[model samples]
Target: MPITEILSYGFMQRALIAGTLVAVLCAILGVFLVLRRLSLIGDGLAHVTFGSVAVLLLTRVGAQSVSLAAIPLVMLASLGILRLTDKARIYGDTAIGIVSSLGIASGVVLASVAGGFNVDLFSYLFGSILAISPMETWIAAALFLIVLVAIALYYHDLFAIIFDEELARSSGIRVAAINRLLVLLTALTVVLAMKVMGIMLISALLIFPAVTALQVARGFRSTIVIAAVCAVVSVVGGIFVSFVANLPTGGVIVLVNAVLFVAAYAFRRCKE
Candidate 1:
């Protein structure tokens, strides 16, 4: 089908717009996360989202409200990870692992108690981007703008912290506050991204484009731009290709990003 015909459908339009916005958001935040060695944070937050969704379902929250309700829960979990790292003196990965395990376990127990997953829950688990509502598209746009503005405001501090936190702190950067902001933003991105990439594949969306850009990017700003471009391409291409091939949009998007990563790696090797 032609591009115009595919985009003529309302669902397709929503998916394209929402998916692109979410992809760019993930890619931008992902650059910081990957460099900070917090890439797994996305996966951890995603598991929390799964558990939160289960709780919401059991509580009989309306399907339309589940995504909105999940934001605060996941944000709290993100802060919990930070607390574990700070007060408990746990390593970053170890802290993430602890929270991630708990989140998934809670979801499993709750799911079993609820007599198993429902159709709505399954959609969240595996994603249903093609069925994205207009409200969600608006949500995506809002999230994108918020993240963009935050990054602009904290660009220098984020840059400093990414390269050397201790040095950033010495420079009066308030590394702790920046760290919290990063994770909180990441939490929000993870929650919104559940509908685009699903809980299982959300990490790939967060990690792939950033890593791919790193393979070839010349500077930090360039990396962010390149990562965003790669993510946007993956989302747009994934939506169209999945529709044509009758495959899952979330999985296809991840696969597209993986392909981009491989291609980037190959290009880097050839250049070397």
Candidate 2:
């Protein structure tokens, strides 16, 4: 079908909206994830969404509704991992690594239980961004607004903790509560984006644009702003490429981001 024919379908419009919203939020949450040095966790949780999708499928529930319902469960499961790790001696990436393994393991079991060969499983694993619907768009939009408000309300504390946890604690930043909120936000973003990039490439959607921004950004605000722009461009460009090349949108989006980074790096060198 031609692009015009494709646009005639409601799914495509919803997909564009969903992709744009997820890209924006991922770009935002990713800054903190990168700052916290837990980029792998972002990837891991995304894969975890895969498993959760699998489990939800086993229940024979609807795919569109499953995501909204799964958001809280996924958030709780992620938070549970954090709390468990916090109770023990491990901190930082090590803890995330442990939880990631557990989440993936659980997801596999759930997917298997749902059916040994649900074709939808493949789509969930790799993503089917073109199939996004109105509900998914709304979900992403609402979550974006919520995250925006939360960040605004706690900007200073979040910055303090991101910059230095000890200093944040010394300044009475409520580190634990803040950390939980961040994890929850991360999980929420993952759920919304899991549809577009799927479990496999969602983390790239989160991290790469922020990295692209870091190369040219002078400060935190500038970095994130640039990243958001880069992210939107990557998503829109990748989706277009995916439509034309018949490839996965998630992978293409990440590739575009990588290309941008290389371009930025070369351009900076030329100027220097």
Candidate 3:
């Protein structure tokens, strides 16, 4: 099928628009998380989204509202991960692991109690971007703008904290606030991205683009730009390929990102 024919379908149009927006969001936030070694947080929070979706499913919430409602619940879980690290004296990965385990466990038990997974739950598990509603697309666009603006406002503080929290704090950067903000933003992005990449593969969207950019980018700003471009390309390319091949869009998108990473790594080595 020609690209123009594919773009003629409304569902395809929605998928492209929303997927691109969420991909860019993940790429930008992934840079900060990757630099700080908090990339796992995306995976961790993705599990939390699963649990949150399970709860919403159990309540029989409308499909459209589930994403919005999951936002706060997952945000709270993200903060809990932060608290575990700060007050419980746990390592960051351990804290993420604890929260991740709890989230998946809750979802599993809930699934069992609810008489196993339903189609709705499965859609979220693996993603259904081609079925994204009009409202969800607007949500993606709105949150994309909000997060982009927030990052722009806090870029310097985030940059400082990513390199050295102690120094950023000593420099009067309000390390705790910035840390919370970062996690909160990440949580929001993860929830929004669940539709684009699903619970199982969402972190790839966050990690791959940013890391791939690091292999070739010469500066921080350039890294962000490159990552965003990579993510957008993956989403667009993945959607078209998946459409033509009748494959899962989310999986194809991740594979596209993986291919980019390998190519970037090879290029970096060749340069060296």
Q: Give the number of the best model, judged by lDDT.
A: 3
* Candidate rank order under lDDT: 3, 1, 2
- Sliding window of 10 residues with minimal summed lDDT for model 2: 108-117
Candidate ordering by TM-score (highest first): 3, 1, 2
For model 2, residues 92-202, the per-residue Cα lDDT tens digits are 677777777877888777766665747777877788899877777787789888887887788777778999999999987899999888888888888888888878888
Candidate 1 residue-wise lDDT, 194-255, digit = tens:
99888999999899999999999998899999999999999999999999999999999999
What does candidate 2 score on TM? 0.93
Q: Model 2, residue 221: what's the lDDT? A: 87
lDDT, each prediction: 0.94, 0.81, 0.95
What is the per-residue lDDT of model 3 for residues 23-42, given as tens digits with 9 covering 90 to 100? Answer: 89899999999999999999
| Residue 87 of model 2, lDDT score | 86
Each model's RMSD to truth, in Å? Answer: 0.8, 1.9, 0.7
Distance from true location, Cα of 117 in model 1, Å = 0.9
Backbone clashes for every candidate come to: 0, 2, 0
